[model samples]
Target: MIRKNYNSLLITHILDGNFTYVKNGKHTTAHKGDTVILDCYNPHEYYTENGFESIWIHVSGSNSYELFEEIEKSNGTLIKCKDIHYVEKLLFRIYDSIKGDTPPSELRISVDIYKLFAELLNFQTTKSLGENNYEDTVQQIKEYISDHLSENLTVNELAMAAHMSASHFSRIFKQQTGFSPYDYVLIFRLNRAKFLLKNTDLSVSTVAYKTGFNSESNFIYFFTENVGISPGKFRKLKF
Candidate 1:
């Protein structure tokens, strides 16, 4: 069907059958387990030869444009998800929140949308780098960040640890690891939070405190934004 421009990010997850998604003067077929992340600012259309089922979420936020740009640059708008099962769960959770009696707060929605964007980027990074190579400097940077996720980390500080200027270090780091220092730090902290949530019976507050968030609320917010669910919900669903 012809879809008018949306002032938001539009995501479509195909569960069954296939749909043709057109954008930017090009079109692609999205099959079962395929995901299409498109900027609604552009005119787009979806057509199906047969009836199809899909989950769609429209998101708008400060980070939406950047995430959309990143995805477009690296993997274009279509994401053949590496983990469809996990993606399905996230989509269902978003769907539930939208369809619930008490609609979820905007914070909740933004977080879920960011989480989905992160997943797409992570998958693209993984796919673009099929081989594994970790240098000592890269490993050391990761270790330091992981060890001090509870502390405020700055580019200068991380660059100092690597014995390089901030700009130079950032350039090489992104080239080597497929993530900027800032993005890497966030991913590391989020991963650590996930581990703690899965392994410990700690309260959300405690997890937040341990994961470097100044307050429980902040931690929960960041976690929800990155993981697409509250810390409690992630713990329950994952564990």
Candidate 2:
């Protein structure tokens, strides 16, 4: 059985015990360290077996559909352990932030959640294709991207990070990800922009600049093309 929460999507990191979920007429089971994606708009039910414990994040907003679509596109699903370590770390970070008595800001929390989801997507994509030395390469590339989202990222730089020639790295990356390196970067930037639009008071131009767009027009074009809405309209719809 599947239970639906119409107002919020649930990300549950099951620390222990058994879990099951059904989608598209199929059922899947998960053990400890697994994560589940419960789509609020979809009717579904799930339950824990013995010694069930998990951390759940409830996500809702006008941009929620966009987030869901991204996850779905990358084959994210319920009762999977893809990127469990990253999700587990994020859960702890969220807990720490709350327990540390820092004033809660919606934007900060939302950004963290988005990053967790993005990492999960990347993990799933990389895992399915079974690239050589995938784990280390992906981690290195992820760190490089995070550190330099404010700067221009080119295939040559990414190849250097992976210690491969530009052409070889591009081919291998596409083989592993089904997306070119640059396309992945653009998608990542767009995801960040979505978080900012929904969670921050920053102007669209400022958000674009902060997310590494060369200009507002470039940001708007890419965001609108990928996200199905202009940045200003997206912000207005969500905020």
Highest-scoring model, lDDT? 1
User: Candidate 2, residue 178: CA error in Å?
Assistant: 27
Per-candidate clashes come to: 3, 5
lDDT (Cα atoms) of all candidates against the true structure: 0.76, 0.71
Q: What is candidate 2's TM-score against the reference?
A: 0.48
* Candidate 1 stretches greater than 4 Å from native: 128-239
Highest TM-score, which number? 1
RMSD of each: 18.5, 16.9
At residue 206, candidate 2 shows an lDDT of 93
Residues 1-239 of candidate 1 have per-residue lDDT tens digits of 45666688888899999776656534355778889888787788665545689998888876788878988886667786789988888888888988999968767866777788888877856543422223447656866876777788888999999898999889878986678999877766676677667667988888777667789888888888876889888888721
- Scored against the true structure, residue 7 in model 2 reaches a CA lDDT of 72
